[model samples]
Every structure is written in C-alpha cells, then in structure tokens.
Target chain A: MIGTLILVVCCLLSTERLIIHAPRPGRLRTPDLITLRSDQRFAQLKAVLPTTGVLGYVEAPGTVNAAHYYLAQYALAPLVVDYSPQHALVVGNFFADSPPDLSPNLLLIKDFGDGVLLLANKDVR
Target chain B: MAVALAAFLCFASGFALVSLFSSGTVPDASAVLFNLTLSAGFGLGIFSLAFFLARIFAISNIIAVDAAVLVCLIAALLLARNASASTNLLMFSPGADEQWPRWLRRILVAATSLALCGALYAAIMQALAHPQGGGWDAFAIWNLHARFLFLAGSHWRDGFSSLIPWSHPDYPLLVPAAIANFWTFIGHDDPHVPAAVGLLLTFAAVGLLFSSLSMLRGRVAAMLASLTLLATPFFIEQGTWQYADIPLAFFFLATIALLAVSDEQSLARGSSSSGFLALAGITAGFAGWTKNEGVLFVCGIILARQIVFLRAGRKRSEINPSFHRHSSAFLLGCAPVILLIIYCKHRLAPPGDLFTSPASMLHRLLEPFRFEIVVKAFLRRFFSFGGWLGIPGTVLLLAFYFIVGRGQRRGLPAGHRASILALFLTFIGYFCVYLITPYDLFWHLRFSLDRLFLQLWPSTVFLFFLLITPQKLPLSSNVSR
Candidate 1:
C-alpha cells in the first residue's frame, strides 16, 4: 500500500513539474535570452578577435552581472575573456544608446554595432 | 544530424565493448536495457578518451580516428563472439516474474511507462527552453571548454590556461572532450551536441536504475523505484542544465550497479566475476573523469571494498583467494583513465584550488562552528534536496521502508552492503571537504551541497530499494532471498 501511494505521489509531482516547466507559446526564458542575445551581439566581434589570446573585458557598470560576462565569454570561446581592462585589446560591452565613459588610456578601435566595441589599450606596449 | 550520427556511433562502440564481457548472447528485455544503459555511458567515455589522445598526438582528422575506433571495436566484437556464456549479467532469480500478481505488475508497468513519458516531455521542454544549457556552469565551464578544444586547432591546450582560473582548468575533460569530439566529427559546434549528450546520460541513468532493480528484485519494485527518481523534479532539472552532475551521478550508479551484478554472478557461478569488477573499475574511473567529487568516490569505493572484504575474511578465518585477482582486474581496468587524469592534472591544467596548504586545511577542519554549519546543512538538505512537492521523496520513502519492514532475509546481499559502505564513506568524504572548503562556508554549502547530494541520490535509491523485500505482494513466499 505504501509503495502504491508513493508511486501515485511521484506521478502527481512529476506531472506538476512537467506542466510548470513546459515551454509556452511566445515565451522566452532568461537562459534562452542569454544565448540568443549574446551570440547575436558577439557574432561579428568574434570574426575580428584573435582566435586564441587573452582579451580584457569591461561591461556597462551595474547594468549587468556575471551572467552577461559569462555569455560574452561563451560566445567568444578559445579566446580567454579576462574581467580586467589591462590588456592591449579590450572589449567594451556597453549599450549602443548609452555610450560608456572611457578612461584616457582606452581608445575605441571598432564598433561592431551591437553594443560590442573593440578598444585599444595604450597602457600596454 | 551530425550530432545524431555521433551519438549513434558512441552507442554502437559502447555496446560492442560491453558485449565483450557480458555472458549472455541472447538477452531478455531487462538485460537488454541494462546492456544498452552501460553501453551509452561506456561509449561516451571511451570516445572521449580516444579523442583526448588524438588531440595529444596532434591528430587533426578526428572523424577518421572515431571511425577507426569504431572499426576496431567491431572487430573485437566479432572475434569475441564465441568466448563465454558462463556468467549472467542480469542476475534474475528463478520465478522472478511470479513473485508479483499479474494485475499489480501490469499497473506498475503502465504507471512507470506513463511517468517516463511525462519525464521525457519535461526534459525535452527544459532542453528547448535553454539551448545554451540550464545553468551558468554549462556555458562557462563544460561547453566553454568544448569551444576551446573545438576552435583552438593546434593550440587546444590553451583551454586549460591559468588566465581562466574560474573555468576550473584542473578539472578532468570527459564532458568537454566528449562534446568537442562530436563537434569535430560534425565539423562545426552545435549546442545540440551537449544537449543530446546530457539527455542521453540522464535517461540512461533512469534505465540503469530500472533494469538493475528488475534484475535484483522484481518488476514491481523496479518500476516503483524508477518512479521515485523520475518524480524528483530536480534530477531532471539538473540533467537538462547540462552540468556534469548528472554524468557524475550516472557513473556513480553505474559503478555500484556493476559491483552488485558482479557479486551476484560470483555467488551464482561459485567463482569471482572479475569481468564485472573490471567494468566497475572502468565506470569508477569515468566517475573520476566526470568531476573532482568522482575522484573522492573512487577512493571511497576502494576503501569500502577493502573494509568489506576484511570483515568478511575475519568471519571466514582467512581472506578469499579471489580478492587479489578481483583487485588486480579492477586496477587494471582503472589504470588507463587514472593515468590520463594524472597527465591532465600535471601537464595540461593548473593546480586545483582545494588543497592549497595543509596548515590552512587543518585550521579550517578544527573549527567547531564550521562543523556545526556543515552538519546542519547536510541534515537539512538530505531530506529536501530533491525539491519534490510537499513531503520530500526520500524521507517519505524511508518512512515507507520502515513501515513495510525488512523481509525474511537476515541481512542485505553482500554486494548491497559493500555499495552502502562505499556511499557512506563518500558521504563522509563530502562532509570533510565541506569542513575544509576555502570558500565562504555558508555560500559554498548553499550552492553545492544540493548537487553533492544529487550526485549520490540515484545509487542511494538503488541500494534502498535493494533492501526492501516486498512482503505485501501476493507471491511473497516466492520472492528471492
């Protein structure tokens, strides 16, 4: 009797999770947004970036967190994405409409037109 | 399409290899499922090893390497066709089907099939919703490493550079290398490859649980146990998240299952089943390759087997003559992967972060507050970790087991006892690691304790079910000892 009861409960709970987590029409979850948005954002930059080297990264301050940084890293893998602005080439992940305040040592090298900016670091030889 | 073909090839390679050791040429339904489940895991593991070696040797044509591997496995399979049918892998007893009423068996089977379909739907929906994977670890660690290996060409070793310390460069490369291997065959990286691998491993775990129970207990017990696993929402969630936890859990369960089967075959044949033990060792090695926690499990299993054998030897007045043979076979099977792991840690990757200094570790281990925190968290998560609705599934199941009472069998089967001991030792290892973790105690426990519990949950379920002899069934008298 106990075994039967547990099986019933399991069936009910599994059904509940199935119903709750099933993808609905026109619904985009955050993970989906991360993959789609990040891939589209970095598609062109990936072509210009060296296939294998460490590059400095700066994001719009407080506008994003580790998720965006990880997505950027994911989209441009084989190239190490460091979270500091100390390398010869740095990536500027700022909103296209809201341009980021740059330090004097950083110069815009190319704007890949999706808030994906390549900046040259004058501090490095 | 390329991903599908790669998976099929993996399945084929694994099946052929496992067939080399299995006893039965003509298998029953349950045995077929058991063989196929092991085949999936073994196939992926072997392919990953082959791919890693190919990379190490600077072989660019991975497709050719895989094809050659498949062809060699096929050749071995053909050559070994007439070897032996002396040992049965299924371990089913006489009159196993008659132990439960036909109607009850039908109900359990139907319910289990229905629940399986529902779980599959949920897993698919979850995978579709997160094509990049279900968690940050997937993209940041597992898939990110795959991208490195797939894209770096001659410089694949750069993926393990210290510049990306957060990526856990010291971790073993089974998942990453497996995904990258498939991508190399396809000639492009697709998110589908990892997603498919994750789903296959997840379901293979379910299938293993079901078949192993069916072989050991009866169909009724098997279905009920599998239902509990499928019912656990987080098991499915973690699996679709594409983290290594599911793969880790799969191998843990596989090792345990293989050990149990080996013991059963040894008892039935009146000789040591070294073949099964060798397979167990391989699975345990694969566990080590899956995650660092897996290395702990490998140690735990070794220690547990030693203690179990020692106790048994004490009762018998001398150690069993087969112990040395069994140990040697297991170590032989485990050697290649262990060597690979050694090379990976020493040559390719940076030092792991956990055991930086003994003094600091001992200092952390001595803190009473840390122990208290870890103990409380472990106790709390043990019941609630599966994220089941209302009453937690594990607690409920334990309560039911007590209520039903252990049947006439005086003790658990020796294999079951050994597996339980291994799991307990592994649990203790987890506790100790928690006591000495360098990260903030509360934060680390909050994030990882659940996954740690999850890694052992399937094997725990199998062992628990193995102990419960169903007395309420109509043919209880006929149930095997």
Candidate 2:
C-alpha cells in the first residue's frame, strides 16, 4: 500500500515540476495602453466595462462611433450621449435616463471633444 | 510511408526512453529526453494522422505529411529542452503491472490504437468529401485566416479583416498556421488540414483522458469516460466540424489531470504538489488561448483555486508566493495568444455593429432576462438530443448524478469536490453567457449547448463512475488475480 502511494506521489510531483519548468511558447507582452482609433476606442471601452455598467456616448459621425456589437453585448452598460453637439439629445435606456430626470443631485459634466458626459451622486447636485 | 515511419520512430523512441529512465533515482537527463520524445510523438502523431488521412481521402489540395512530421519533431525537441515538471501529467500514471493478465492490461493499449485508427480513417473520409469553400466557421473565421495566410503570403498578417471584436485575431497559430504551412509547402491551400487536425487533437484529448483515468481510478471509470465522450452525439459531430470546443476540452482534461496529480501528491510526503498546480495553470491558460470562453474559464479556475486554498487553511504568506509563481507561469504561457487576440480585434479586424459603444452595454444587459427567450432556449439546449446521441448519454448523466448524489461512494477527496465545483461554476458561467447574448438565444443554444456540455462530459463521467462503481468491482479483482 505504501509503495503504491509513493509511486502515485512521485508521478504527480514529477509531472507538476515539469509543467512549471517547461518554457511557454508564443507568449506576447504588450504595453499597458495602446492608442486606438475613435471606433477602436469605443470597442476597447465596451470590452473593458462590466456587464451591468451603462455607457452613454453620442453616435455622431467621427464622434463616438460604435463598431463591434458582439463585443458590446458583454459591455452592456447604459449609455446616454448627445450624438450631435448642436442637439442636447439625452439618449439612453429607461433606467439611466430616468435617474437623472428624477434626481436633483445629478449634474451634467463638461463636454469632451465628442459629447457631454454626465456625473451624478444622490448627495450632490 | 515516410510520415508513418517518422511517427513510429517518435513513439518507439519516447517509449524506450521512458522505460529506460522510469526507475532511476534522479530523473534529470533521461526523464527530460523521454518527456520531449513523448510529447513530440503525441503532437506529431496527431498532426500527421490528420494530414495522412486528409490526403488519402482526397479532402485537401495540399499533402505534406513530412512537414507536419518535421514540425512535430521540432516541437518535441523544444518541449523536451524547456519542459517543466508541472505539465508532466502526461506521464503521471500508476506504475504498470507486468504480472497482470495480458488481456486486461492490453485493453487500453488496444483502445488507444483503435481510436487512433478510427480518427485516421475519419480524417481520410472527411478529406475526400471536403467541402469546396470552408465549412460555416471555417469559412467565416478560422479558415478565412488560413486563406489569407496562403494567398497573402508575406502579407498574410494583413488578413485580419473581420470586425467582430470578440472573435479574437492574434490567438495562437499553432493549429491553424500549422495547417496553412502544410498547404503552402504542398503549393495548395487546404483548410481541411486544420479542420481534420482539430478532430485528431480532440481524439488525443479523449485518449489521454481515458488512459489516465484508467490508470488512476480503474478501467471501468476510464472506459466509461472515454466511450461516453466518443459516443456523445454533439461531441462526435463537432469533431467532424472544425471547432475550438474539442481543443478546449483537451485543455480542460489537462487541467483535471494536473489537479488529480496534485491531490495524490498531497497525501505523500516529499512530493512537490505545486508543480502540478502550475501545470494546471498553464493548461488553463491554453484553454483561454483557444477561445474567448477560455478567458472566463481561467477566471473560474482562479476563483476555484482560491476557494480551495482558503478552505485548506494555508497561510496567506506561504500561499501567496506559490500562487504568484503559478499565475505568472500561466500568464507567460497564455500571454502570446491573448495578445494576438487583442491585436486582431483592435488593429486588424474591421469593427462590427455589435456593442462597440457604451450605450450598447445597456441594451445587452436587459437582453438575458427576456424571460420567454431564455426559457425556450434553455429548454431546447437542455432537452434536445434529437440529432446527436445525446438522448442516451443525457439519461446516463442524470442517472449518474442521482446515483452519486445518494453518497454511495465514500472517501471522496477534497480535490475531487473542488473539481466538481469548478465544473458547476463553468456550466453556470456558460449558461449565463448564453442567457445574456444579444442575438437569437434559442438558435445559439440549439447550435452550441450540446458541444458546450461535451467540454465537461469526460470529467463528469469519470466522477460519476468514481462515485457509483462498486469498490469491489470485477476489474479490480481481475487485476489483482
């Protein structure tokens, strides 16, 4: 019994050691950040966000161009953005849009190059 | 003929080296050589088998078994020299019994040979009946890359045309590129090589799983697991179709083997268990390299390992060093393929209309809770076994579950429980992903659920046998006698 147990242990130990010592093939190292095209930026943003977070970005041409829908499905956060700078179009799903309308504490942040971003807390206006 | 000769040499050399060094006090030079040779045989045997079968069946335009054989040889040398103790589960079996009945002892050897022959035959038939364009995903994604590699030549790197962000580009090119390289060598582009290669690898995955389980648990458990996977309707179907699921299954089985080794080592003093843990990490990383779903699987494993470690009451300081090392090793193994996937999505492929913008996330979050769709899709995937051999297998799964749940088997190890938990978590993760998908959930479920189930089938069946099979089974007696 002890012999069988020792054999099993040795085999397991040796295999494990082999895996750790083995040189990994085809491993790539990338910088923390890479510059993305406007559309690619949107894809990156969608890829990074949590499933429940809402993303509200304007859909104007050359502004916030959404590219990969499948990637965005996992990025299912609500987005409320003004597509055209001329129009204050607060477009988003019911939950995100409703919270701003219902609360006095919410405030619209300054417009970035593409569109206005929103900031809100229940305690602050 | 040369290809067959090369494969024979690889196997013979590997077996001889293993036999030569298996009993030595220090497993340094000979052990390393044995591992390298065996891995080479394992990889090349599968690769050549795919190509040889493809050529015989006339499914592919290209025929360069020699190139694949060469690649296998190179890979073997590389793996042997750079080999780690962690991934050595390939060699981790109970000591062989020379005194056992020849018939009983030879069953696995025979089964393995038969399975390889069957895979080779299937590859030939698949090659002969090769489709003009690529099959669905082959044409849509995997083969498209192969097409670009062959046609674009030096500019093949420029073929990252798909805008599907999630459909990773820079993924490992070991399988697909190997196929394309063969095609290039033979002066003809043939996607069937890779497709068939995928099938043969799946067979290897099944074979390894069977052989390992048979050695560790018992013959019955191993046979059940292997036969169940082979007979799985969806598994067999997907084996024919060139998909990433089988490879992922291979990685999954690899992870289980590593864990099993680690567990066995834990019970024995002077054993190095961390090495298996590290190998498990590497295999898990490869699983991620195979597909986007693999990333989620990695997350699941990390979480599972954390849970197991904490439950074992290992101190944070002691555990942290080992955990960090394993994680780094895993990342080192996985990083290249992951980077390629990222590069493909960000730089190469055209962006699609899927969730590219922040607003898309909102739309998708609500999509899964579409009650009617979720229920219908779940039901279809869970119950529908019409085309595949799922009906009988599903019945067996249920029976196994029920029988095992009754606690017929005693002394189940903690590692076994952890693995079962990990499997459950994986199933839930996949299930939730399907639920949340923005597309036609029902159709997606019908298409993929069975294949998804195949990923866990081998492990599940093995666990089932472990629980239900009587301790005094006849096989054990036969072996002892």
Candidate 3:
C-alpha cells in the first residue's frame, strides 16, 4: 500500500511539471486564445457599435479574420452577430497590417482607425 | 476580499439550510471542511435559485443576490439555533476506535496535506496562465454566456440566441448563472470570479470527499479517498477551467454524500424524514441544472433507488411503509428544481446537440460499427483520464477492490447500498448516451469520453473506498505499511 501511494505521488509531481511549464515562447499548448480581451483596433468601434439589434459582420477572407469574427462577436455580444454583410449596418474588420479593399456597395459609415471599419449596407432590404 | 466575503455569506446560508433540513447525523471532523463543502454545494443551489428569480423579475443585480442570500442566512440562523449536531461519528473517529502509531498517522496526514496544497497551487497558477479561460469552451460558451447575462442587462436572453448554435444555449445555466451572479455582485465581470468558482467547487469536492468518508467510513478511509481524488490531474485542471463538468461533478458527489448521510441519520433514529435524501434529490436535480448529463443523473438515481427499494421489498415487506415516505421526501425536494430545469429547456433554450431527429437516432442505434467504435473509445479513455501519471484512478481503484475483496460487510446498511446502486446506474446512463449520440461516434467518444469519465471519477473513488473499507478498521501500528 505504501509503495502504491509513493508511486501515485511521484506520478502527480512529474505530470504536473509538463502541465505547468509546457507553454513557452515557441511552443503552443493548444490553439485556443489565452485571453478574451479585444484588440485596441476595436477600442473605438466596440464603444460605438449599436447597443442592440442584429449587426451584420464582415472581415477579410482568411483564417485570421475568421478567428477575429469570433472575437468581434464576443466583444459586441447581446447584438445579433451574423457572418454576412447583409444587415442594414455591417462591421468591416480588417487586418491591422493589411486592410481589405472595399466593394462598390459597402458605403463607409465610420473608420474607427487601426483597421476597424464600419459600413452602411446599400443593398439592405 | 469582497469575493471571499460573499462566498462566506453563501456558505453561512448553506450551513443554515443544512441545519434546517438536517437529520442531526453530521460526523465529528474538521468543522471548517464540513462547513465549506456543504456551503459550496448549498451555495451553488441557492445562487442558482436567486438567479432564476432575478431573471423572472428582471432584477438580476448585486442588490438582488445580496437580498436573497442575506434573507436565507437570517432565516436559517434564526431557525437552526434549535438544531442539534450528532456525535455518533465519534465512535469511528481516530483514537476513539483504534490508535495508530503517531508516526504512521503523521505520514497519512502529511500525504493528505501535500496533495491538497500542491493541487491548489497548481490550479491557481494554471488559471493565472489563462486569464480568459482554461480552454475553448470557457470563452466560447460558459463565460460568453456569462458576458451576455452580466453585460446585456434585460437582453441577456440574446446569449441563448439561435445565431450561436454551437454555444449550446440549451445547456443548463447553473455555472454561468452563478458566475454571472457573482459578476453582478461585484458590479462588473472579472475572470478571477470564474477562476475562484472553479477553485471553490474543486476543493469543495475534495472537502466533501474527505469529510463524508471521515464521518461514515473512518478517518483513514476519508484521507485515502480524498487523496486519490486530489491526485487526479484532470479533476484539478477541469475544476480550474470555467467549465460545467466540474460543477456537475460537485453536485453528483454531493448527491451521493447526502444519500449516505441521510441513510446514516435514518438508521440512527430508527425512522425519520430522510431530509438528506430530499437534499440529495435536490442536488441531483441541480445537477441537471448544471449540464445535460445531470438531468440523466437525476432520473438515474431516482430509478436506481426505486429499483433497490423494490428489490429489498421481497425480503422485508414491513419496511415498505418507510420506503414510500423516503421516496416522497426525495421527490418533494427534487420536484421544484426539476420544474425549473423543465422551464429552462422549454422556455429559454434551443434543442440539444443530440437526437435532432428521432429517425437519425434510431438509425445510429442500430449500427454495430458505431457501437464498436464508441465501446472501444470508452475503454481507452477510461484508463487515461485526468492526465494521471500512471494507471488511471479507476484502474487503481479496481485493483484495490480486488485486493481488498468485494464482500459487503454484514454491518452495511440498506440505504447505503441503495445509494451505491444509484451511482452505478448513473454510469449506465452515461454509457447509453454514448451508444445513441448524434455525432460521429468515434470522434464524439474520443473528444469527450475522458471528461465524461471524470464526472464519475471522484464518486467512484468514494464508493470504492467505502465498500473495500472494513466495517471496523483497526489503525495500523506500524509506521510503514
């Protein structure tokens, strides 16, 4: 019985080492974000986004923007978060390093700088 | 400090509730632990109740939580003054029965302390590392829902909107509601609150494990049982993560613990209102309030108890009179929470992930290949859960059982046996869920089977230690076993 317990203790100490120190500069523990804070790019728009109602959401076509859409939705919750730019107003999130080129119909509503763009949907019903 | 004080108020209210509904069979042990475990369990139940009321009245705020909890505390304090505590556990306590060598006792005590402090430290550091959450589910589902409830004001229902189908809006709201209530009390959202809730439940589960065993089984059994649970890596991590599984597990173990306490109290008095059974049923019902699987546990425990009662009937029909009373007491405690859950499912939430169509479920059930995959995955995950360093805790428990022998001590009571059966039935319910899942069988099993296994892991250790332990164990005289 003592041997068994000693073994259990040893296992606990060793396994905990990997768990505690696994996340390093070059090593990613898992793909999920470590924190839920919004980027400063959204600092302006997040405050100005409509307080309620469906908010159409659009972002640059890439894996990173898709992830950002999730973040934007989280930031602007209680409002209906949709992936298409079909609502009366749409949030145009673009990469801070490379902003998206505009289409003909997405009229600029506001540019909450650092890559956060808001557009009024001309094609809205 | 404010969070700690609020938690204390919550614990006081829970202790008062326990006193009101108690059978006076509380065992002699660490008063702090006993109070903390019961308080955490009772606190969650009360918080959920208050949150539910707030939603109904559109008044979920710090004032509402403070008003509700303070009222409960005051009323309980006034009423519980007349309540009595039991000393029957004194007979089984250390030094009262068998005196172990001081050296051996020290070793056991040290081991318990080490496991606890180590787990607590690791859990805090892990939570500190992930300020957002421990995993994807925290921010995506639980905390996200809390954000809606906390920040959206009257529009909190938007968190349950169908637009976010993957968020499992249909899931019960105990963890989120409790967190949101805490956030509301502090007047804003803070990641520390969820991290702390996780901490409270994790250690509370530990406290329950240790205190319950010490009361019923003996001090050694309590220490060993708690040590095993504390040693589990995943239980600690999941407890730190802002997830519902650990909350569900807490309620699950509370149900089993309360049943044992009720049984012990009833036997002591010869016949009494099994208020503990009622509380156990309520805890199980609140389990449903924690997650979808908890609903299954509520039904499973009730059915398991009934089956055991009926089985006991053929041998002793005279006990049938008390059986009905106990059953009714349980239902009375459980029905209100079950009603709340039913309301949530029907009124506030969307459909669940599984069984979207009766036809698809029927098709899935008949496929032998899916069955094989799920069964295989269950077998594999069962052995490696909680990131255990070596053999899984379950396997270690089984080995211990084999070594100790499976004989039911002649002194073991019927009610205790009944509770064990209910736990087994809950496991069976989990197995059946795997068989009829709507998702790809292997993928579903691999991703979730470990966590699902963890839900029962603590209870399994508790029951295993309870059964294998002698009806009367003598303290070891030797320093080394």
**For all the predictions, what are the DockQ values?**
0.54, 0.01, 0.33
lDDT value, residue B129 of candidate 1: 77
Per-residue lDDT of model 3, residues B1-481, tens digit only: 6676667666666776665665343333553465468767888777767776687678746555656676866776566544544322222335422544556556678877877777777676666666566766877688878778777888878888877646788988888878877776677777788888888888889999898777666777787788788778888888877888988899888888877656654555445556677777778888988889898888878887787777777766224458888888888888988898898888888878885888878877788987787777777777766676767676766766655445534445666677677777777777777888877676777677878888887787777777766554323211110
**How do the residues B43-116 of candidate 2 rate in per-residue lDDT, one tens digit apiece?**
43334334323433444433344445445555664565454322222232233243235564465445434444
Provide the TM-score of the second chain in candidate 3: 0.91
What TM-score, computed on C-alpha atoms, does each candidate reach?
0.94, 0.58, 0.89
Off by over 4 Å in 3: A1-33, A39-41, A64-67, A102-105, B1-5, B23-27, B60-62, B80-103, B317-321, B405-412, B472-481
Q: What is the C-alpha lDDT of each candidate?
A: 0.81, 0.47, 0.72
Model 1 misplaced stretches (Cα beyond 4 Å): A25-33, A61-64, B82-91, B317-320, B470-481
Superposed Cα RMSD, model 1: 3.5
Expressed as tens digits, the lDDT of each residue in B1-481 for candidate 1 is 7767787788888888787766443456777898999999999998898888999999988877888889998887667655643444434553655756778777777777877887888888888878778778988899988888889988889889877647888888899999999998788888888898899999999999998877766777788779888878888888888899999999999999888767765654455557778888999999999999998899888888887887776654333458768978778877789889988888888888888889999999999999999999988997786877777777867676766644424555455677899999999999999899899999989888899999999999887777775322222211121
Best by lDDT: 1
lDDT of predicted model 2 = 0.47
User: What does DockQ come to for candidate 1?
Assistant: 0.54
TM-score of chain A of each: 0.81, 0.23, 0.72
Which one wins by DockQ: 1 or 2?
A: 1
Report the candidate with higher TM-score, 1 versus 2. 1
